[model samples]
Target: MPPAPDDRPGPSRNLAVDFCGVSRSYGRVRAVAGLDLRIAEGEVVALLGPNGAGKSTTLDMVLGLTDPDTGTARVLGTTPADAVRHGRVGAVLQTGELLPHVTVGELVELVAALHDRPLGVDDALRTAGIGDLRSRRTTALSGGQVQRVRFAVALVGDPVLLVLDEPTASLDVASRAALWETIRGQAQAGRTILFATHHLEEADTYADRIVLLARGQVVADGPVTELTGATRGRTLRATVPGADLDRLSALPGVRTAEARGEAVVLHCTDSDRALRALLSTGPSARDIEVTGADLTDAFLALTADPPR
Candidate 1:
């Protein structure tokens, strides 16, 4: 059966994809239930979760590859699967099932031909960061190279909403960073993007917003800041030889005190207050390095069991 229609009601007036109380099951297994989400036009959102957390299921529903048992998934004002049939959506699944017999250039041309209107081969190659790989046969390319080719294919059609499922799953660190830039560029060009990933730090750094899922449920959803809201503030990591970790933990306004090598990571509720207190402690306090709470720490704190 085809996925649900994309004209479902949404929270935003400009939502590109909106899901309302959506549920999907596999007989005895309830993979996802009552998941409500709204992604606006031109916004890049990351769906983050552990294995079996329903990340792939959600993407499949959005891309029209899987039908939801109940509720609806709307893509750009039409049904998801129908939208794809109309050439309104493009997606790159984790496994890029490109035709092994075709050359990258040939497959690209074929895809571009599907749209009466499409960006040319030269443009598509340039945009996908694989201009040099065009002549290479799909069978000969490295896993990372093939993923780029898949990205090219997904982008060649020029759909309004691009859904990428673990596009960087096979890529090395550098390739992943480059793809992040590519996705960011696309978002800046006014295309809405929804990608699922387990790279916690990458999601924090690159996503305009993040949706946290676990055990096939929408445990949390919002901008990185929204989930990381309460964890905001300054941090002080100091390497002090004379200090007692227990004594430092007792200091006022110290959110957390952990030993990092010989240094103590002291996250502060207020930098000014913490800095003043540190200075009064000793001359070695000058070694205290003040920093901000980054997304990594925020992610850990939010997903941590103690938070909720």
Candidate 2:
């Protein structure tokens, strides 16, 4: 709608995706609205949003199962449907979408055979971390195990672009970490990967760029550092001489200030900003310290939006 991709310097120079006011709607509910975005090659972008925030819809558009009623989605310079058949694009959708009656091995082979040159059954299984589950029926595998099979399907094609929608859902922390490692391995292999998830920390810990979406539109997009800022004002303990920490807590954008031991640990938007305010509090200010706000604090501050 807005980008007018056909009017640009063609797909080769444009972003991996060229969405100008792209949107999809069913009846009165708009799953996605007029949205414009660009994803470059080899970019690992994590889509983060609340439930029903259109994350799944966005992935579907990228996968070509659902087309936008308004605007369009281009995967790696090609329409998602054509991209699947010709361009390099892979996706593990929310539904798993596995053929229940087939053994994992058969499914793997079927997908691999789609390409003129595909990975060996053994190699796909090995790469997908499901070598041991080759003979298992797709319907019988555990969620994590099935998830691995889904990856095997997406990956066996050797697509240049990979889309994972909530790839770590229903996984425990350990499983989630293992899944992350696997995805990182793919990224290391230089695949342009885009994963959608609700977990901020996972996006922070794994993705190269965090693309935040809300209410059917992109709210923020950038490297973790760019979105959060330097230092992130780490969570630090500050020992101050004052009992009235409310003045310190009330500092603008200071998320929380709690007294611990002889100091206080503050979670805030700008740790530097918070630090400066705490230091100026009359004679009661003493021993002000600083620490780093991990991804949580950074994400919290970045995604913060005024009430609509």
Candidate 3:
């Protein structure tokens, strides 16, 4: 008797996904240029970048849907195609076209049948939070429901590594949050996951590490806290009558300052110093408040090009 699918070899202890000197080009445009990224087993990593940043191309290479023009893309100590063929890899790409007539349950079960060893259909459904929608026709489901079903399909293979491309792109706030919880749960279960998204909050909140891409190259890579801290600080807001916004902007530890009605908003590197300066130099300074930087601020500042 053959080993069950669940008994197949799991992801190796080494890299789950590795790109070495990989490059791809289309006509006159370069999609990925001399890229190198290594994702270890059982890690949750986010590939973050704006449009035209080669994120999709990188995922494509990892999925074996496209070949790198110059170098190697490896998964699980083997080619991506080999890993996928052995049921070690699973993915939810940006676009999915579910059959209209099949119920969600049937669709997922069908996908499970294609793999050597797969999770029980019901288990996949429950994991994806779509068990209640099992009987619903695929065509009748809402966008979020469709995504959930697709996630179930991805899990049916019981893959060791999962890839999701902008899984929450079309979801509303509530759906996005719900799906994020599911993804986090998967990561916590020791499954390696790689997702690509432009949402700063998603990367910051859910991933163990963030790999920031720019113009087809890795611009930053590190733990979420360190990467965000590199570009983030406290913000100071105060109601200062007849505020000298220019002077405030030039204050020590203040990155930028602007006036909004009677309030001056300051993006600060050192909030304590900024506040001290405000009180000592400006007679009208009052109603001062300081806030820690959120992901949005860090993302923008990190992605911004530095002065020449």
Candidate 4:
């Protein structure tokens, strides 16, 4: 989820975010390769990858915090810097030290004041689920609370494009879910959101689209369903007590089979064939369930690289 590298060409007058042949590197390591991507208004997109995958670098370009060595990063059809200056872009970066002395309310209010057109401090706080904590000093809040406060600071600008870099890292399940709810509300109201996350479920459940980055390039791009089904297969789970694991693994259409306690799980290239074979051979295979491959499966299949 570190800094990395997209592309599309020409002026996309109405797109929320545009990256055209964008590439950035540090010394000999290319963080982002030539990449092009376009995000429409009101869409929730996730940039997904592992460490050093260039997710952060790509976001930095979009936020105008770092210049691309080649190509351009645009927000709302303008340079990221211009859009940021006009309060049309807001960002929550992965790492930063919050100001020590200010109260949460004061912090949000200060950011709101910087924008010519800004959301009210109270409104931002409410949207970020931190309205009650507004009076707490920045130094006094827990890590999760502090993160929500940072979200409030970004939301105070009422930006059209919200860019977040690993916004939910290290939070407990409850905190992550809470933050996602606030994000979902913001997106529902027509703001375009682009967030980078290592959590596969976050990308699969929340994003309208997923851009899978590996080593500065996109290994996959599409809807969650499409990516999950990228392997052209289905998964079948069935309860078969005392089943013959070796026989199940040898089923004609099944690519792999494993025992999950009292159940047998099958990854199959042909579901119809596999199902028929299972029911015919394993008469005891009951409580059958069929589902497509999930994002985690697809990610491993697609991003598995050859040994260097």
Per residue, candidate 3 scores C-alpha lDDT tens digits across 89-114 of 88889975887789998898889999
Model 1 residue runs over 4 Å out of place are 1-12, 26-30, 113-118, 200-205, 219-222, 225-227, 267-286, 306-308
Residue-wise lDDT of candidate 1 within 44-161, one digit each (tens)?
A: 7889876777888889999888888988888888889888887778888976478988889999999999875677877887888999988888899887788888888888888888
lDDT of each: 0.79, 0.78, 0.86, 0.86
Off by over 4 Å in 2: 1-14, 230-242, 245-289, 292-294
Q: If ranked by TM-score, best first, what sequence of candidates would result?
A: 3, 4, 1, 2
| Candidate 3, pairs of clashing residues | 5-117
- Quick one: best TM-score, which candidate? 3
TM-scores of the candidates in the order shown: 0.81, 0.81, 0.88, 0.87
Candidate 2 clash pair list:
234-291, 234-292, 234-293, 238-263, 239-263
C-alpha positional error of residue 153 in candidate 2 after TM-score superposition, expressed in Å: 0.8
lDDT of 4 by residue, 152-257 (tens): 8888998998999989988899999999999999888988899999999988778888999888888888788778778777889999877887888889899888
Better of 2 and 4 by TM-score: 4
TM-score for candidate 4, please give it: 0.87
User: Candidate 2 at 233: error in angstroms?
Assistant: 7.6
| Tens-digit lDDT track of model 2 for 63-175 | 88889998867877778898888637888888836897989999998888788667688887888889999888988988889888998888888888899999989988888
